[model samples]
Target: MTVIEIDGLSKNYGADKAVDGVCLRVEQGEIFGIAGPNGAGKTTVVECASGLRRRDGGNLRVLGLDPQNDRRRLLQRIGVQLQEASLPGAIKVGEALRMYASFYDKPADWRELMDEWGLTDKRRAGFASLSGGWKQRLFIALALVGNPEVVFLDELTTGLDPSARRTTWGLIRNMRERGVTIVMVTHFMDEAAALCDRIAIIDRGRVAAEGSPRELIAKGRADSLEDAFLVLTGGETA
Candidate 1:
């Protein structure tokens, strides 16, 4: 049950390749991760898969539909939380959620989502007034509002506090339990090792290495995922 498939996928920025002849597959209901250092093609590849960017070459399919050609259907069935998302500063938390919910034919309950994301007290707060963690939580809640079968999360915990990060991780696990597939892009090795079923380590516009956390670590002959990633990518650990 492959939910996503990429064959020799490539994306170019002017003359430079951002994603170069990459191939990967994500199974249905699995938590797949794309990990890499800065300047790597992780973002490019995920953006291509999400149909936000058109690929320069190769084939890509999401749930058996061509991502670029069948974008309308794909967009309806998949949720995306981009690395940098912007909302109107004057929009209240609840207003924002309701606006996003309107885009979907069937959406989750806004009230329940507010409480679950610990956003109840901040429901009336303006987007500008919310803390970094609260904003991140709201983004997560919005992404899930559509009850999408597959979700793309990029740097989801980037600005969250330690407790908030853990809380978001728990919510991600809950999404998995509900049979939702997740495609996550992150620089955090610990998050990848802990949550990902399979990880693709991309570097210099290509997949440098890929496997389960244990398999990757074993292949690198490293003690931990961080050490393995550093050894493989030749980059410093965060």
Candidate 2:
């Protein structure tokens, strides 16, 4: 089943086209990746699908309903972890989890999630005192608190150490096993290659390519996903 459908979607900021004629579909339980260089309109396309940004053209549907028109209902069924999320300077980890749980009609057990994310030791720590990896883990826990059907993660592992990145990858795979669909946006080609069932590569406000990591690399006659992406986008040293 298709959980998301975007057809000829376009978004513009004044004279600049952020997303242009982009089309893609995500299956019900797949880990879908959107990859591109900076300013490739990846974020804009995600925002449009998540109903955070309205498109200037084309159509978008999440679970068979218009994301813009059915935003309230859609939001209840989906979770989002934006690139730049912030919390109160003094908010404790436990308190932050509780606050997020209160927003959903049926939230997962905060303690369980804390343990799953290895956050029990820092439950009483202030949000400001947490390290980058801890903060990312907290965000992941918060995104899953609602037991959402679809989750959107933008640049999920940007500033993490290798160990933390691998740990987060395991958590993401576990989420898929529990039947949650994921839409991830990242600049890291290896992350997409390792996690995504299918990937859409965007360039200059358009989809430059779409396929499994292996398929894309095969098409480019390249040995790696990053090389394929560079070839397609005409990047230097690609």
Q: Give the alpha-carbon lDDT of every model.
A: 0.90, 0.91
Model 1 lDDT per residue over 143-166, tens place: 888879999999999988888888
Residue pairs with colliding backbones in model 2 are: none
Q: lDDT score of model 2?
A: 0.91
Model 1, runs deviating above 4 Å: 236-238
Candidate 2 lDDT over residue span 1-238, tens digit each: 9999999999999999999999999999999999998999998988889888888999999988788999888888888888888898799999998889888888889889988989999999999999887898899899899889999999999988999899999999999999999999988889999999999999989999999999999866789998998888888652
TM-score of each: 0.96, 0.96
What ranges in model 2 sit over 4 Å off? none
Give the clashing pairs for model 1: none
Candidate 1 TM-score versus the reference: 0.96
